[model samples]
Every structure is written in structure tokens, then in C-alpha cells.
Target: MRKQTFFLLSLGFLSFTSCIQEEAPNAECDIVTCRVINLENYSIFYSRHDAVKEVASTDSVVTFPVRNGADVSAIALELDITPGATVTPASGSVQDFSQDGVLYKVVSEDRHWSRTYRVRFVPMMVLPTEYKFEYYELDPNSQKYYNWYGMNEEETRIDFWATGNSGFRLSRSSALPDEYPTVPVEDGVSGSAVKLETRSTGAFGNMVNMRIAAGNLFIGTFDTQNALKDAMKATCFGLPFSQKPLRFSGDYKFVPGKDFQDRSGTVISGRVDQPDLYAVFYRNTDDEGNDVMLHGDDVLTNPNIVALARLESPLTTTEWQHFDIEFDYRGTVDAGRLRNFGYNLAVVFTSSIEGASFCGAVGSTLWVDEVKVTCE
Candidate 1:
């Protein structure tokens, strides 16, 4: 009887030790605990122990370990709830945690998806930031419009003004004295002697007669020297009509002595019956000792003088008629000829005068307007 009792006690002790060895420390816990972490921004989330673990010993529970700085906003778990296990807080909420090592639950929501209980703690706010510049409108009356410059020992001030038409004007004061000319404007004419009033001078003023003659205004003359040299500089704008081979229409008449050459015996005439011929139309260098003359085989000789155009009028001598003359730069001329250097146009007259007449007598009289240069 003593031996059997000892045997039974030993057997019971062995069975108890075996049962203890078979059960895991985790399996012995009534509730499992876990923590969620955000790796991107170092945010943390705490889980509830009682809410995320199984109550029965047969139930399986998992606990996840998280660090202090981890992102738990999108935390997830792979485990499904065990048959005998119950999870708390059906769905997890991302929030700040007062402590670490929290428990979580893996609970099914529907037939397709399941959610895990989690808490997110973010220390810093995630937002977009940008840099920008401040802009201000320019003030016309501001003192910034003037610039001051210091020379040797003195200072000079320069004023700048932006005009209403988007143009700029500058003024400066000098220590030295200088002479300035008076400017005036009359009937569309503008010069140093005249202040320019009309921007559309081609419509009137010096070009007024040109417009009346041509039925259109040509950009007559600018202050540019080249424009002054080229009588038909305004033709650079464009042609007016559909007529082929652009033409200049005008009327011209000659008087023997008054309009023609005088006693200098240069074979050149003095003036024409129409003063407009010499005054308004042609660019004459005859008075300046340069007379236009024809040279060998398609070459003209002259200095400081360019014949714009010439045309024979079909109008009767009694009536003021119109004529058209076309001039072009591309034409064959003699080799090594100065006249051929810049031949933009040519003008021929029915009456020819000797080269000698240019020095003594005045040239023929011709009135010209309505000049047109067309592109071929």
C-alpha cells in the first residue's frame, strides 16, 4: 500500500510537469498585446490588451512588437480570428497613445475584407510649403524715376519719364552752357525748327502733295540720311494697286529760259514752268555741281543725284495729265561704273540735254507724285 501511494504521487507530479512543458508562456496569457509603428515618419500606435486577445485557452492570439518612432496609420495584420477567440474594437483608429506595448485585434468586417485595431501617433504635421515673391505696380510720380550720378566732385541728376504712348523721355542738367534751337510745326511739317505734331505725316505736311498725286501717302522722309538720299524711300512700304510693273504718275512742262538752263552754257536748264518739279519732287544736286548724265551702254553718271522715275504723259499739252514710270534696281550696266553702284530705279526724258548745259543752265521742269514701287 505504501509503494502504490508513492507511485501515484510520482505519476501525478510527472503529469503536471508535462502539462506545464506543453503550454507556451504566450499561450498561458489571457490577453495578447501588440504595438503599431509608422516607419516613414517615426509615428507610434498603442493597442489594447483586453480588446485584441482570446479569452479561452484553446484560442490562438498574436502580438506584434513596435518601436517608439513608427507609422501606424496604415498598420495591418495577416492573422484571422481563431474559432474560440474574440477581438475588441472591431475597427482600429489612428490616434495618439499615452503608453506603448498596446494590444490589437484582427477582426473580419465582411465576406471579402478584414480590419485590424490600431492606434497611430504622429508628432509632426505633414503639409506642403512654398516660397513666393511680392509684386508692386510702378508709380509714375515716384522719386525713383530719377537717377543721380556723381562726377569728379559734382553730382548730376537725370530725370526719366514714361510717356502715355509707351515712349520714354530723358532730361539732364549740365554745368556747361550750350545753344538750343527753336522748334515749330505748321501744316504737318516738323523739324528742329518745328515741333512734330502729327505722327501721320505721310497723310499731310511735306508729303501732302505726294498723297494727292499718288492717291496714297508714302513714308516720305525720316531723319535718316539714307532715306533723304533715296527719293522713293517711302516706296519700301508696299505697292498700292494691282497694275503690273509699279508706276509713278505725274505731269511736267518746260519753259525755255525760266524753266530751262541759263547763260552758264552747261546745256542744263534753269527751272521748269512748275516750281513743284524742282522744289517738291526731284532730289536735285545740279545746284550743288552734280548733273545726271548717261554713260556707255546702260549706265548713268551722276553724284549726289538719283532720278526716281520718268514717264511720258498721254495728256495734251493744254491739260495736266498723268504718266507712269517704273524703276528697278536689277538692270545690266557697264562694268566699273560708279552710276551702276546703287541703281534702284531709272528715269528717262524725251528731251536730252548736253552734259555742259548742267553747269550753266537750269534743268527741265517736272512735277511728280503718286510714285509706286511694287515687288515682282
Candidate 2:
């Protein structure tokens, strides 16, 4: 499952006593941790730990993955919130999560701030084979950017795709949704497809040495907290996958921007922008048994990578083009580890191949649709 779990850190006995002597509540409203209780009753989950999810600071939606037929209509949830904060619908209360989702509101201790979060239980019975880019809407929190979501074969909504648009929002907060780096296009090869473009990050970006933002989408999470300071780490890549991938195919239309630029936003003569599309399969643990995830810097060249599939040549075309690449295995697969969720898979697409280095040509665009992964 792509859903990340958490480890509840133990608080010191001294801290517990200090909480009882609190005189005032701080002005912070956040869900620090969340876990589903009574896991024994839910036989669908692999383990008690698998049902827990650590809420990200920038995330508004919390999701847990369970078997497709699992009943979550009356499950109990426990939430650890900020000091002196209060949560609506109450913690440790039974709620229905079989449909859309349950919305919970958290108010700061001083009532100066509030945040609404939607918690969901996602069914994970089958892997998604085809991506049609069908469902998308404006970012619910900001309403200033676009978000793309996919559906599984069972017609259940899936949130396996993540984008750098959230990071772009920091640079171009006043820009309209359509003007952002990534957006949804109504006139696609099929229904609605995703359009990625390399965009200029105004004066603030240049001041921070981040002159451009590239449009990118991948099968992983984006940590908005470290976006500006450490972009390579911000793009956490890959998701747990049990299947062995054979081929990756997709359709795309690309038009490169002229006069490619460097990290300092300086134009390079005779240079042209190039788009990137690739997938990686790798082990998800280090030698010491600690969880490991690839980032933008190591996704392509990581030593733990078992197989990779990448476009061999730069694709530059105005008309839609189809591409099918075969996975090239570099290491043997461990069947037992793969079955135990010990491996991860990453599929990535970017409007500018060098975008990770803050180098790319603004106005370069790439339209993609009908992507699929053929597995063994």
C-alpha cells in the first residue's frame, strides 16, 4: 500500500505531569497522530501497524488502505492533536468511513485557528493498470492550483499520483489555477488529460536561486515542508508494489521551449529543453531494516534499484506520440520480500528533464494520457 504509517513517540513521564499543570493553551491546531483502534475486529488489515497513518503537516486528507470488502462503517479512530486543541466529531468515536469520507474539524486552544481534515479508508485489492487522467479539480485547500486523481479497476478513487504543484503554489500563490505548472486539459486524447508546463517563478524564486518550476507528476508523495530548502528530498519517490513490471507505455505530445536555461536562469546557446518519462523498481529498506524511499536525486541512479524503464531518446513533437519501453533489470528480485511489501515502484513524468536542478526552459509543455503498466 502507498499509505504511510507512523510510530507514536513515547512522551516522557515529566511531560505528562506538565500537561496537567498547563495554565494556557498554545495557538496551534493540528492532528499530530492518528490510529485505528480494535484492529483485531478488522481481519482485512495485514497488521495493527498497517492501519495507522501519520498525518503530514501540509496534508488535509488522511487515508488508510484495507481490503476491498472490509467493513469500516463502524470503526473507531484515535487522534492525537496539538496541546489543548479540540477535534470535532470527537476522538475515539465510532464513525462511518465506507463512503466518501468523514470530515473532522480541529480548533486551536485559543480558538484563533481551525483546520478541516477529511479521513478516508481506501480499498486495496487490485493494482491500477491504466491511467486515463479522468478525474481532477482545483486544490481544495488553496483553490489556486489543480489536482489530479485516478480510479482503480473497481471504480474506486485512488490518490497514488502526486505533483510538485503544491510547491509551485508557494512561489506563485496569486496566479490562477490554469496558469500553474500542471493543469487539466478538457480536449485530450480521450477524456481529460494532464498538461505540464515549465513556468517562471517570479522575483521571489530568483532571490532564492529557484528561478523556474517544472511541471511533474509521480507515484509518490511531495513533502511541502522541505520544498524550497531541499527540493531533491521534498520529492519522495516510489510506492510499495508487489508485482514485477514488464513494460511501461504512454501517449504524449511535447513542444520544447527555445533557449534552454541553467540553474541561475541564464540562457544557454544551442540548448533545447527535453521532457522525461521513466519508472523505477527498487528495494524499500536499508541494510539495517529501516524504511527507505528514493528522492529526485537518487530515483534514477540508486543502488537499490532492481529494474528501470526510461525513454532512450529525447522526444520532441507537436503531435501526440506513443511510447512503450521495456524494463531493464539490473538485480534479481526476491519473491518473498516482494510479497511482504519490501519493494517499491516509481513512475515519473516531467516537462523538463533538468528541472530538478532548477534548470529548464519556461513555456515547455507536455500533454500525457492513457498511461499503463504491464506486469508479470
Candidate 3:
């Protein structure tokens, strides 16, 4: 989230109800938003594969996937500028995107401030068959490890890896992604692995009765629409997966907190927090042609899931241990559907088993490293 615009405005309420309103005279630095429309036509994932569009990563550099002979040479931009401010290269104009890093600028109404944005497009690459969490560069602006992509033997960045940390950082102490519960730990199986801890959501979250957000790492996008109200439904799971995974192997270390309690701070007598680890491969769409992505509530029971792998419980290890879970197929996979991206897969790890419902011990922690997904 490095290239995101900083929001400087907040409001209580306006007495009248009108969609259109007049702008303030001195609100010069009000050029609030900008977007590259028409990106879906050439982009591989406008959001989370087919689950979303337009609302996906508003990252400064957008990648457009053009085929060998397809005509994806131009793109259109849409801007929401200050009332009296001006944006160069006018909106709705089809500008050539054949070069790398196209620059767009916005000038404030009072001529006191200006903003510049760079637009970049990249051709798509094949999704890797395995994930070896090898490469990541720290996002300087947000201080979050945004890129946790796996690399193929050929040293190419795989397109299938994603995480749910972005949603988890919304209510953090400093909006710094590093302050999030899930982050990179130097002492990993390979080089750096992921550390997940169940954390207290602080005063603001307690006011809303959402006292906690468990530290989690998973293969999916965090849809903001559902996270605040119903966290179980908020973490939409799975990504386009074709591999018929047979087993999941990884190394992990876990520690339980001293006190276990529900969101209300009521202690659960004699209870020790445990980490939850699982993987699910399912169909991408339902029979009625609607997109299907499992949530915490339905993931284990969803009929769409063709196979599942869950680690055994009582995960209270202080030393790093190798763990392996076998996938048990529930039904046959349509071979033809595999060629297209009709299958979805999800891998999840949480510090607390009941973290989805905001129930957990704040200090519970889980460290994971060198995950190997064995598939057919």
C-alpha cells in the first residue's frame, strides 16, 4: 500500500441530504483520488481473480497482462480531482501505455501544491507450481512486508501468492503494516519465515466490541466490506488453484498465552490457546454461476471444497518441528476445469483456533517456515 493517498478529511454529519454539493473556496490540496479504469480488459487480477473488480489494489503501478498478439497498447485513466484543481493529460483520454512508467500530475487550485503519479504495466507470467516464500521487499511507506511471492526454479515471481495482512492492519496502533500481528521473522526454516500472534485491537476496537484480531497468514484477499462486522465472513478464502495437492509440509513453533478468554475478557477456565493450520482446495464457482470463496464459518463445511488438509491439534511446541498433513479428496476434479482457472485453493495459519470470532489470548503466538505444498 505504498502509493496510497493520505486521507486528511473527516466529518460528523451534514444536516441536508444531497448527493451533489459545492466545494470549499480554499480547499486547494483536495485532489483526493485517481484510478486507471479499463484495466480489467487486460489485467490478470483486477482484484482477487474473479471475486472482485475495480476495487482491487489501487497500487501506483498497475500490471496489464497482454497475450502474445493481443492489442493492449493503450489505457484509460479516471481521476477525482479538487473542484478547481486541474489534472494533466485529461481524464477519459486513451493514452499510449507501450512504455514503462507513464507519469501523471495533478496541480492544486491555489497553485500551492502538486502531486505526481507513475503508471506501470507488466505482462503476466505463468503461476508457479510450488511456493518457497523466498523473496520480499519491505514497503517503505507502510513499513509492511507487502511482497511475499514465491519463486519458480527459473527465478520468476509467481502470480498466485497473496496474504490477508492488509485487512488485519486497518485497526492497528500505527497503520504500519509491520505493527501487524503477521510479519517476517528472521529465524525461519530457510531464511525468513512468518510470525503470527493474537493481539488486542486496542481502545477503538474495544469500543465496537471487536477487542481482538488474531495474527494470521493465508492465501486470499481481505474484503473490507465484511471484516468490521463479521470477521468470519470477511476473510474470503481460496485463489485459482489447479494443482491436486496431496500433502502439506512445513515447520512451526508455537507458544500459548497465560490467559485464555473470549472477546468480552471472560476467562475460559483451564483453556490453552492453540494455533490453527489448514488447507482447502475447492471449486471457483457455484452451480448457479456465482463466484465461491470460503470464509472462516463455511470453509471446513463448504460443499465446494474438493479436498482438505488440517494439522492435528495440541500445537504447543517450543522447538521448531516439521509438520505434515495429507489432503483427503472428497470428490473428483473435472480435468477440463483445471486448464482454466476454475479451481481455488486456500492455506491458513492463525495464532488462535477461534481467532476468526475475535476470541483468543492476546499473547498466543505461532511461527511458521518453509512450507512445501506437495501436489499431483
Predict model 1's lDDT versus the native. Answer: 0.26
* Candidate 2, poorest ten consecutive residues by summed lDDT: 1-10
Indicate which candidate wins on lDDT: 2
For 15-80, candidate 2 gives per-residue lDDT tens digits of 666676546667889997888985566576643445678788988888776756788888778999
Span of ten consecutive residues with least summed lDDT in model 1: 126-135
Worst 10 residues of 3 by lDDT: 4-13
Candidate 3 backbone collisions, by pair: none
Q: Pick the candidate with the highest TM-score.
A: 2
List, residue by residue over 127-156, the lDDT tens digit for candidate 1. 111101011123243322121111211222
Q: Once superposed on the true structure, which residue ranges of model 1 sit more than 4 Å away at CA?
A: 1-246, 258-309, 312-318, 326-364
What's the CA error at residue 299 for candidate 1, in Å? 6.7
Q: Rate the local accuracy (lDDT) of all candidates.
A: 0.26, 0.85, 0.70
What is the C-alpha RMSD, rounded to one decimal, of candidate 3?
Answer: 9.8
